[model samples]
Target: MRKLASICLVFLIYFACSVMSAEDRTIYQFTVKDSDGADVSLEKYRGKVVLIVNVASACGLTDSNYKQLKELLDTYHERGLEIAAFPCNQFGGQEPGCDADIKNFIADKYKFDPDLYSKINVNGADAAPLYQFLKKEQGGTLIDAIKWNFTKFLVNREGRVVERFAPTTAPKDIVKYIEKLL
Candidate 1:
């Protein structure tokens, strides 16, 4: 009947659109809140090599990782390298603090200022959609679940998640990859 035909056409269109969207999805499509609670579109980092890291203030890896991250930012920030740090408390309650407290902690301990985002859950049912997309793009050896804090996702200029580094991977160890993308 005419009604059946119309419904079938609608379904077809919906299916086609979903397929297209999946193909076109990228990091640029996400907008996340910063430490100050302002929404920041990832699109702003387009055309830049971005290192997206889930950070923690009290984690054991904090010192060395933040130190090396500062060095990397200082060295390559002008060369189109951006480090986007997202604070996550999903691991061992390491990042337990308000945004202001976390910011102050980073400043006092690391003496470094990073593009800090709001605290978010990186795993489980409440994981941020941005983290979900990154995990889907490059799940690494442990699959979609993020193993620990400081897990980093390297996004190329095109906003594709090209690499996933473990929590223990030093920021300095990623310079070669960044250089290649730059």
Candidate 2:
């Protein structure tokens, strides 16, 4: 009876640990809206290194970041680097336009087109599930809340969030890491 109880206890412990460590969803499991409000399945990017960024049109870091992002995309896009840009107005209302306006603004200003998604809240109760997943995967300085626009998450080809970058981290600075993943 003692040995049987010990075995049962060990099984329970193992079951609890496995349940606790299991992930409910992966990056590829999410389906987000694009600038056109169409459902875009992240599974399309499963085999590529993905760089997910919370973007804004009027943020102070917008110009530099956009330029560098354009450069990075132009350089490595054909080499398996996929940039997923999600516009957000959660930071200072910097991105107050509707989807069409935001799309036009990006086109006129940057002349660079990325896989831009629909505007989303990166913080607070209404934050998008994708952002929530990302924050949970790699908690920021504030843990699960995006501090500002341009905060980036680097995802491996396997759809796991591998690294988190602060809003101030430049796209050029992230090139080495992306290269290593590629």
Candidate 3:
């Protein structure tokens, strides 16, 4: 009877700890597709500040955002600021093009060297699981559905969602947040 009590106590402790962990968790399990179509796990960036953006090639802010995004990558990449861009078209078919074309435009126009991936849905029922997780993790003051292209999510070094930036928010405006994370 003593041995049975000990086993039950151990199981209860373990279960309680598991429940606590789930409640206190940040986002460290999401996997997104890299520019090469390979699974890029967020675990690899556990100790880095991540800036995730839903991009659109033909959008009005595309060029400016790409330019500033390039600057951000060049400046803070070594300092652990990771910029992940996901081409999206859900806003207004602004990103209606193949991956290669999107890549070429970014390379030729803005000289952006950050990781760019295939077009993905940023809103609606078809949104990627990663986006779904992001929206849930850091919904804005107004709504969860991304308002437009270039919507950005800032994740701290500990994989905790820190803030959300609208498409109109300049990439330079995010420098302060990056510094805060650092």
Top TM-score hit: 1
Q: Write the per-residue lDDT of candidate 2 for residues 1-182, one digit (tens) a residue.
A: 99999999999999876685424346987999999999999999988999999999999999999999999999999999989999999889999999999999888989989999999988888999999889988998856689999999999888889999999999999988999999
lDDT for every model? 0.92, 0.91, 0.85
Q: Candidate 2 versus the native: TM-score? A: 0.87
After aligning candidate 1 to the native by TM-score, how far in Å is the CA of 60 from where it should be?
A: 0.7
Q: Estimate each model's TM-score.
A: 0.91, 0.87, 0.84
RMSD of each: 2.5, 5.8, 4.8
Deviation from native of the Cα of residue 35 in model 1, angstroms = 0.2
Model 3, global lDDT: 0.85
What's model 1's lDDT at 160?
A: 87
lDDT of 3 by residue, 55-163 (tens): 9888999888998999998999989988878998788899888888888888898878776766788788999988887898788767889999999999898888889
Q: For model 1, what is the alpha-carbon lDDT of residue 87?
A: 97
Against the true structure, whose lDDT is highest? 1
Q: What is the lDDT of residue 181 in candidate 2?
A: 95
Please give, for residues 1-182, the per-residue lDDT of candidate 1 as tens digits: 99999999999999976786544768998999999999999999989999999999889998899999999999999999999999999899999999999999998988888899999998889999999989988877947799998999999998888899999999999999999999
